[model samples]
Target: MTFPTIPPMHRDLDFNGPLSDERAARLIHSLGPLKGHHVVDLGCGWAELLLRTLATEPEATGFGIDLGEENIRHGRAGAEARGLADQVELEVGDAGAWKGEASDVVFNVGATHVWGGDPVVHTENALTALADLTRPGGRVLFGECFWKRPPTAEEITAMAVIPRDQYRPMPDLVDFALSHGFRLYSLSEATVDEWDTFENGNAWGLEDWIRDNPDSPDFDEVVRLTDAHRRLRLYGRDVLGFAYLTLLRV
Candidate 1:
C-alpha cells in the first residue's frame, strides 16, 4: 500500500538513537531458535533487527511495520540485498493497529508511543498488544527508557519536555512484567559507551546530511535537530537509561 512521504523536518525531528548492529545481533540471538518461525517487529525502523534475525534463521518469515515510508523503503532494500525479500515483508502502517497472524516472536523497541502518548498507558497497552500478537509460549522483546536514578525536582524540570511519567525505575518495570504474567527471561541495559554511540550516530547522520545539502531549505531545521541532539546527549546521559527486556508468555 502507498504511504505518505514523511516531511524532511519531521524525519529529522524523529531521529532517536537505535540499537547498534552488534547489540541487535546479541538481542536476536538471545531469542532462541527461529527456524521456520514467524516474527513481527512493531515500529521496526529500518527493520534492522527483523532483517538480521531473518538472515540468521534462514527458514523464518517475518513482517516489519513502521509509519515512515522512507524507513520501509530502506528496510525493503536491505531485505532484498540479503536475499530475504521473499521471506520478509516490510510495510508502512501503524504498529499499534496492524493485525497479523500469531507470531512466534514480537519486538517493539523505543517506540512505545504506538500504544498511546502516555508512557504508563503505552507500557501497559503495548505489552497487551504484543501479547495478543504472540502465540502461546512465544517471546517478546521490549526496549524502553527508565530513570537511571532518582531525579531531583529541578532535574525533572529540566527534562520536562519529555514525558517523565513514562519512565520508572528498573524494578518497577520488572514488577510490571510479572504482574502481566510474563516471565522475565532476559534483560540487557545499554552501557554508557553504547548510549554514546547511538546518540552520536544520530547527530553524525544529521550533520552529514547538512554538509551534503548545504543549499537545501531544510538546513535550518537540521541545525535545530543538531542543537537538540546536543542537549539530549549532555543532559540525558546520566538521567535517562535504556534497556531491552525479553519476556516469555507464561
Candidate 2:
C-alpha cells in the first residue's frame, strides 16, 4: 500500500518566519523605491516578500532561490497569481553558491545556514556573502535568530538538536553586521505576539492535517513531529529571539 508523505510544517505559513503583514510592509518600505532595481532573495521560502516588493514596484525585477523545490513551485504560482510572472524568477538552487550579479536590494531572512558549517561561523560568512552580493549603498534585509537571554540546560535539552551557543545576543548580532561593513538602517525584534502566532500556526496546521488524514500511515510520525516542535517552541519562545536588520552595504 502507498500512502502520501506529510508536508513540512512551514507549508502552512505565509512567510517562513515570525513575520506579520505589518512587519513585512515596514521592512519593504525601508528598502525605499525599487523602480528598475535588481532584488535578490537568498533562501527565500516561496518569496512572499519578494513578490510583494515587485507588486509595489512593477518596474523592478527580482530573483529568489531556495533549496526546497516545493517552495520554489509555490513562489512561481504566487508570482503568476499576483501578475508578476514577467518580473520575478524563482529557482530551486543553492543560495550560498549563487554567483549572479550584485543586487540593489538583498534579502537573507532566517536562512543564514546556507553558508553551511558552524552556526556562529556561518553567520559571519553569510554577512560577508551578502556584502559582496549587494552593490555599494544597496540594502540587505537580514533576519536571524539571537539569544534573548542565556537558556538553562533543560531549556537547551528541549530544543533537541540545536546547540546552546548557536546564536549570539542581539547586541552582538548588530555588532557583527557593523563589522561586516553594513550600516544598520533599522533594527527590530519579533514581538511576543508574533512569536505566539508563528508557533501556534505551525501546530494548528499539523493538527488540521491530522484531522484531514486520520487514517494515513504517516499520522503517528507527523503527530510526534508536531509535538516535539510545539514543545521546543514553548520552551524557547522567550529565550530565543529573531532580529530583523535593515542594513546598507557601505
Q: Evaluate all candidate structures by whole-model CA lDDT and list the values in order.
A: 0.78, 0.88
Query: Candidate 1: where is the Cα deviation over 4 Å?
Result: 1-18, 209-222
TM-score per candidate: 0.86, 0.92
* lDDT score for residue 17 of model 1: 48
Model 2, CA-based lDDT: 0.88
Across residues 1-250, which tens digit of lDDT does each residue of candidate 1 receive? Answer: 2222223332332224446667777888878999888989999887877888888988999998999787888789878888999999999999888878878999888887887756557888877787778887888888988888876666666565666677789999777866776889899888887777666565655666767877877777767767766775677778888989998877
Model 2 residue 117 CA deviation in Å: 1.4
Q: Give the Cα-based TM-score of candidate 1 against the true structure.
A: 0.86
**Best model per TM-score:** 2
Q: TM-score of predicted model 2?
A: 0.92
